[model samples]
Target: MTPASTDAKAIWRAFERTARADPGATALSTPGASVTREELATLASKIASAMRGAGVREHSVVTLMLPNSVEFVAAFLAVTQLPALAALVSTRYKASELRSIWAGIRPDAILVPPQHAAGVARLLDIERQHDMVVPGTDQVLRLLCVRSSGPASVLDVRERFGLRDPGSFPALFKFSSGATGTPKAVLWTAANVGAAAANVVETMGLDASDVVLAPVPLSHSYGFDLGILPLVFAGASLVIRDGFRPKTILTDLVDERISVFLGVPVMYRVLNRTRLDQVPDLSSVRYHVCSTAPLSVAQIEAFRRRFNAPIFQHYGSSETGGICLHVPSEIALRPGSVGRAMKNVGVSVVGTNGGALPAGCRGEVVISGEATAAGYVQGETVHDRNGFQDGFQDGCYRTGDVGFLDADGFLYLDGSRAGVVNVGGWKVSLAEVARVLESHPCVVESAVTAQTNPRRKQRVIAAVTLHDPAEEAELIAFCQARLADYKVPRRVHVLEQLPRAASGRVVLSADDLPS
Candidate 1:
């Protein structure tokens, strides 16, 4: 097997060439304005030089929370020039969520939206609750707003900041969504980012001619790596939206002449439910890549039939950028597979004993090679229930997902090990059902789990609290209409209340249930 290709010069070299080759070509754009490659590079250089003057060194960690703005792209590209790792924090995160993440990272510098400055300062005051060093000018951890307090001196573009060794430090630090529980910070080295971008560019045949859409939040790894970073190698045009709205995106699909769309399953579900009288001509779109969460077969089929567009499944996590992407030509062969491991990456299925499982045998999935991150910060386990660990074993990062590899090497996910309930060889995801149930007006909140009955196998069960009185039969019918027959919960129990964790995710346990 070929070793992980960690050559990290691709981003710097590609950015320079793309800028010089066509100085006037648009590199990134929003509804407000556009920036050419030359202009973007110049802005990035200025930001990098300014950051250097603030005493941030190659080893310092910089956290960025600017979203859906041209400044974010410029700042991220500027971070590329410095050896410091840029951590992208979600702007949508609750104040408490942000505090939890920030307390742990204690970034050497933070770039927050100007409006959030006061709130963030309050969050820092709460930092005294955690065991972390508060950041400021006393050295490494300086905080900077996206908008400078006062204006500005332009430093030489050819400054010392641009001379740092690109491969000497990790390039990214991102956090999990914390949908299941507390979020964990994950780090990706320069090699990881470069390899992931290369894999995507190769698999999709994306190029300078392609116009990609940032259909999701740029702060999320989904948008940063898939939507933004891929442009480093391909020099493609990026169309940024203010935020995700069903009507706005549909309009852009036709108006932007977009060739590629980076989206998630939730977005597609919304689109499918919102029918179109004429499925706007999406002939220009070559790849409608979906990731972030698993896309159900019903959702996928509905989207494809309605739009006449191929909805390819992309499976990966914040820890590992793009593990599998369904290629267009191979779609017919492997209908639901996440596709094979990308170039310079390795994937294998492992049994309960941590032994390699044969083709078609479901087990925990483990991935390795250049595209995968080194590990989570401080070796913390992101998902404790999964049999996998944080770091790579034998160079492979044990993903907490359970799935089997076919003879063709296509990986099929069996849902997350913690979230998937096995019912006599059939797999059901609790997260999937929760979404469907939450759609019902009566279902104020719900939790899904499994319990073994006389059948000797686990049966799907959903516990729900209602806004108004609703019969169990009606709710079951509601799910039956939305999900696959097998995926529908076997039992829907009406509970007075559901237990919730600090992160706001429903906790499913006997102790938390109503008596």
Candidate 2:
């Protein structure tokens, strides 16, 4: 295998070569069926050939909106083979959100599933209503529709739109919810992605013998990095599931003899809630990785006890790739820690003055590494001289998380520096409160913030969406029991749905809740 630094395009070429070397080996598996390496490569080749015939060239931006399936993998690799930029858009995004994203970066072409054509057409209509000019059609172009088991339609949409390759384009554009209250797209190059993928494979000690079961959506960072990229790089078989269901997941794990399981804390919590006897014996699995959100000490320990496998809690953001992870050896010793920095990544806790702090002191966690991204699409560059070091000094990417490293090199997260709430001099982490509220039985989702109180200065308020409205008080009582007196929410507001951005992060506004 070639080193990750060889070139971003080299990784795809290597995978294509590997597929040819072991044509009959299984590459991807889902509940519906499985695809051999030969089949996977042939499908990708067909798609790439079709794209070339349709006038796609190097550096063209192709927006992909599809569900998690074999088609997604084929489309992603097919575009990358031409070294074209691939933008993976969430299927859940609304028309308004789509307009905002498309307006900023006009993609040369778009690939949507047949099922999403109507919703996409609706979005184009909404765009026209606002006098916004979409890229392809007078309305949105229903250009490419993926067939179940046949050839892909290559319409003259590319010629119709008069699109052409501009030049060298970013490898991927992932939209993230910005702190300034808007959606910001993060641009990453093929080189950056290849480095990040290599870092993950090395850090996790993955091998071709490993079988990874992924239940998270590939559009998100966690799924894309840990779930998809590592498997592709290591030539490991991927067991792709559309979504997470504890019972079904457990059954698949045992049946597939899965070696690696990656998911979020919420998924593990759901699995832990299932009856122990009903849970399959996952003795074959060696690692269970969790990220996207924090995993409580209780949840971590519970998962370990039930599964008899080490549960690694990792911490990272979409801006920078995998930052920190708790090692399997330290699982028992440092239950809450996210682990030491991975190879080629620098981790630091800086004080308010931007100076590096001593061990055991809480400060903002900053990271720099090979996996760090170039920058956001239209947002400010986060790299700084004192902190970021021009992207070379130790290659450390400054992570915005607030955490501290113990004397033994274990990283303990305190909270996020951006989302802290000052309640009359008492600092509270909104993430901490949100975690407690989300643990409630009736609460499906929750967002916590500091609401102004004329007399008390500020009070903790929680806006929540519940499965049952009548259980609001009961849920509040549940949170009151688990959280500290100061951390407990003083007021709980029930809503049919919580506001969220296209990236799936909760959106809170001053006028949305009580002040």
Candidate 3:
């Protein structure tokens, strides 16, 4: 399709048309089974029918707390088929976390996996006494349980909320991690999801023949946009994995003939340790994309050498979707760069004074484009009078990421905005230091955060998980060889495992770490 013909609205309309035209084509696959387009459409239709039957209406928030599987896909699409909004909650969340999220979102209904049905029921019962039905009646908060083998029982509920206009359907409700503060929900319209899918498909050069293996969960933005939606929109085959297992992924690559592999940095690191000889032929894979967090140059090179495929770096967030993607040419030129801004997207590095910085100057990275969110749900607006600013510009989301662009427009990430260690007058990016430390052969993973130091206002501290425990002095010497004197970690803490989010992002909150 031509560029103009491949816009978001157009692609989504195409998806609908294709579904009607060829319902029998394989659309999705798991480890042991697959779902054809016809089956997907039928299941989604049935679920939507159930929602309509349950009194769901336009703009109603429907919470989805299920694992990464066919049921999750059906539930998401089913919710979208109605005018009600869909909120994706991680299954990894504990009951306490779910209670907090429920209070915040005040969703009309929650679709829970059978495993968590009893806990969800108890939580809803507690909310019932408080009379906190923000969007609808108490009956609206019904649970749609999935049987192990038979059809889902929520068909009647969906039918009660059948939408007259699919265009008005609210796509998703994404919640930010409450680590920084109270968690906030981001509302995404069907139009927004369609646009994001189109951008990703075009940016990645995906086609019908491509088989995508998504290791990330559908609840996360990276997996939803970069993994699920793109393949569905392009009529490409989707191979869904419940979790990230290097051996399992390697097997899928060979068994499914997966052309596209999308994962986080940690996933790639795990895959690097896999015994390639034990897996089936993986030579069919084409592009392997990594996102969510920065991938080190060493890790990128190692992955490339092992897989013989280009490892592309992508940068974006939940609020903005995918704003930047590195193409093959750009990847070759700037090995660790997050490439230039995506097509139809504008990116800039702004200083503290709010002015754009020249190339090679470190500053806050900001982005503006069609794919950016309209606003946050019940929170601050994403854009301001200056065009785009919230975190960065008036309308532009302050990425909270610290980076600079080269003359060629490639972006180099230093660290996250919250990760900088302010030492007296200097700013040290933890990611930069951690990368250097992790390059050591014995180091498996590492995180750098600001630690209290009476001698100085704050000092850089490193928390490392090693394949084989190494002495602090050895680690310090390793960092000294690669990092600057001031940037080298002043204190080192060894841990067996690093705290991680469901999205696979390394959690580095100082309060969560052992003192």
Q: Estimate TM-scores for all models.
A: 0.76, 0.82, 0.84
lDDT of 1 by residue, 1-515 (tens): 11133322235556777788788988888887788888888877766777776655554557877767677887777776764567888666677767677655556567665565567766653221111111211212224533222211111111112212234235577776534556667766666677778767776777788899986778776777677865667788888885678878989988888998887665776677665667775656888888865566666666777888878888777777778888677775676777777666678899889889999999999887667665555322222112234544444677778789999888888666788777778878877788688677666567787777666777677888776799989999999999988789877888876665332235575334333
Which tens-of-lDDT digit does each residue in 335-368 have in candidate 3?
A: 9898878766678999998799999999988877
Would you list the rank order by lDDT, best first?
2, 3, 1
Ranking by TM-score: 3, 2, 1
**TM-score, cand. 2:** 0.82
Candidate 3 wrong stretches, greater than 4 Å: 1-14, 95-100, 122-170, 178-182, 275-283, 378-389, 392-395, 453-456
- Model 3 global lDDT (CA atoms, 0 to 1): 0.68
Model 3 C-alpha RMSD vs. true structure (Å) is 7.1
Q: What is the lDDT of residue 376 in candidate 1?
A: 56
Worst 10 residues of 3 by lDDT: 128-137
Off by over 4 Å in 2: 1-8, 121-169, 178-181, 379-396, 438-446, 452-457, 463-486, 493-515
Writing each residue's lDDT as its tens digit, candidate 2 over 1-515 gives 33343323565686776686678888889887788878887777766776766666565667778678777787788777776667878887877777776665456666676567667655442221111112221422234422112112222212222222222225776766654346556566566677777777788788777888988777777778787786567778888998888888988888887888877766776677666555555657877888866777777777777877678888776767777788877889988898988766678888888799999999888877656665544322322222433222234555567889999878998767777878767788988888788766556567777777557587788888764454557767887888777877787888877776655556776568754
Off by over 4 Å in 1: 1-10, 125-168, 379-391, 421-472, 478-515
Q: Let me know the TM-score candidate 3 reaches against the reference structure.
A: 0.84
Candidate 1 achieves a global lDDT of 0.68
C-alpha lDDT (0 to 100) for residue 496 of candidate 3:
80
